[model samples]
Target chain A: MSFEISVSRRLGQGVIALDMAGGDGITALFGPSGAGKTSILNMVAGLLRPDRGRVAVAGRTLFDGDAGIDLAPERRGAGYVFQDGRLFPHRRVRANLLYGARLATPEARATGLDIALDEVVAFLGIGHLLDRWPRTLSGGEAQRVAIGRALLACPRFLLMDEPLASLDAARRDDIMAVIERVRDEFGLPTLYVSHDRAEVERLATRIVAMPQRDTA
Target chain B: MSSFLALTPDDWEIIRLSLKVSLVAVALTMPIAFGLAWVLARLRFPGKLLLDGLVHLPLVVPPVVTGWLLLLAFGANGPAGRWFADWLGIEFMFRWTGAALAAAVMALPLMVRAMRLSIEAVDPRLEGAARTLGATRWRSFLTITLPLSLPGVLAGAVLGFARSIGEFGATITFVSNIPGETRTLPIAIYSALQVPGGEEAVTRLAIISVLLSLGALIASEALSRRAGAGRGGHVL
Candidate 1:
């Protein structure tokens, strides 16, 4: 899917403006912490509303300030994975993976659970962890499960917020491989947040750099 | 000893009435406590400070004063009580229902505080994750927020139950100690202490009170531990 997001939001005294467009591939938002990388992803996920701008995903207007159109997060069709895997602690791995698929509209669910499950399981190699509790999984394993859970949602775009940040060096390398495989196989447009330049070089098809805000 | 051992018909009535009032109070207050706790922990809106203060008022105010206020608002000739009598043929003054109302008021703060802390501890990022996965606000709350806060909810319920079981001043002031209708375990104990021959009976009731409170605390601890274990052996 192709989309463009041009938005401006106030941060403290200054405004953080974002203008970007890309087709189907991983677009890395590279910046140090507090450089508004996560803010851009939040806007894309409909978690934060832009002060003035438009967001369109695959020709669908998600937000348009003049038209007064703002779709809620759920309606945006973007799967989001947080820095910490936000797996439901009470639910088992299978339940967490199936949550989004179950809640999807009938037409969306028509893709079939088995197909989605098989694809995500193979893509992220989380088949073994299906029955285990989220807490039992290692950091890398948990991140794979989180990614698989998002894939089951069958999102138009995947928004990853520093998904590899919590893992150790070796674990980050392993999980990044799984992420790259999923992105290529699914052919889904992804907005990846990261501070690591090597990660961006290895995974991103395009890069958007954000710098720290200056204090006067 | 014989008197304490004998479970008289009136004693049975007091036992049943106490359970009835406490159960009703706990049931009625759970949803309200959950809502108030969520708002306090998650939302930033105008009047939030006032709402926070109001929810905590029962904790700080004397229970007797709270009962007095309820009596003024729901007494026979009072606005709400009069309307209830005229329109619904219901009365709260000196009734078991009034005892339940007082218990609910007294337990509200404990419930809200436990739930608020739990809700606050939940990762907002998780909710954001659910939102991206096509969950509406209410659905996310039902499936995600509510489940994650289960330990807190259980803790709140247990605390409320303990508070309700031991409630005395407000309950006595609002509903009085009608032996078969409004008298609860605590009231029974208090009454027994006032009589010359009721010393043993008071001891029995006191023992029962202690046992029940201890049981509730143990149950809460066990529940929290189980929940934490389910989340991968990390205690919340």
Candidate 2:
């Protein structure tokens, strides 16, 4: 499956134009902090529309600036894992995981949601934390839940933006193992973003380095 | 703390009538107050300051002045009062409903203020997260925003109820003290003090009023606490 995106944005740092092309496995967008990495992922997720350009996945167009076609985030079929896990404080772990999954159509879950949920529960080892409040969770536990939540949405692809930045070294390694397992378990193509060289070396099938910020 | 059995038929009538008027007043204003609070908390529009000032005028102005304004706008001789009475066959002139209207007006500001504070406290990011998770904007508001802001709603409602129960100057000016019709507890107490040998009756009614107002305050605290904890969210 081919995934390609070419986007140009005018941020305060100056104009940034990013382009990437990849097939299968984890394509890590390696960059320094504030190098427009998260912005690129946000554009693909339809969270932020690029000033100009197009994005496509597996021959389906998700956004095309020339045609003025931009899908809403919910219809983009892309799941996002933020740097800080955005768990709903009002909901339990199970409820947060199931929130978007329940809205998924039958075709979205080709493997069956129950089966997918069970697999995610097994894959992430979050089965025991289902009924607990989000506040009770450790940073590592919350991030894992966030991943399982994204996976349950049955997204066409996953976009992870510094998912390990907030964790301790031990927790970071722990989540890396979970991420590796997720990629291997479903063969799901992931576009991972991080500034850490070690993480890129450990997980990137292809590394796309971002250009430095233009001072103008 | 006189026993309910010790209360004479007249004393019971005043207490029951007071409860009925205040309850109806709260019911009339709850949805409207919440709507205004939501608007103030979430959106901005032209003349917002003017609307806010008008809503709070009753709080700052003398209660008698507020009563006069209500009468001028909703009295039988007034345009709105005339339209409502002629079209809907509803008259507020010397009626318990007029007293209720005054009570609602006096209590509305407190309710809106309390609810607005709570709404402002709720984290906007939570709603944003919900939207990204397939919930429509309206859905996110109902499922996420509303529940998170409920502690304010509970506090507002209870404060409104208490304010309604204590409404005096406005009710007397708008509806006057007509026994078994427009006379509420405050009006009854005021009337009792004017007549000889009505001291015993006043004491009982005053006790009931104090008891009811304190009960409302205590219940609001308990209910708001439970709502905050039960929802498992941070209150503003």
Report the number of the highest-DockQ candidate.
1
Off by over 4 Å in 1: A107-115, A214-216, B1-4, B225-236
lDDT of 2 by residue, A1-216 (tens): 557989888888687778888778888999999888988888888777899999997677889999988887766667678888888888999998988787676666663223367777887889999999999999999999998888877677888999999999999999999888877876667899999999999997889998876667
Best by lDDT: 2
Error of 1 at A149 (Å): 1.4
lDDT of all predictions: 0.83, 0.84
Please give the distance, in angstroms, between residue B198's alpha carbon in candidate 2 and its true position after superposition.
3.0
What TM value does chain A in model 2 reach?
0.94
**Tens digit of per-residue lDDT, candidate 1, span A76-149:** 88878888887987788999998888888875555322246877777777788889998888989888888888
Model 2 misplaced stretches (Cα beyond 4 Å): A1-23, A27-70, A110-115, A206-216, B1-5, B77-79, B86-89, B226-236
* Cα lDDT of model 1 by residue, B18-61, tens digit: 77888899999999998899889999999999999998898898
Instruction: Candidate 1: count the clashes.
Output: 0
What TM-score goes with each of the models? 0.92, 0.84
Question: What's the TM-score, to 2 decimals, of chain B in model 2?
Answer: 0.92
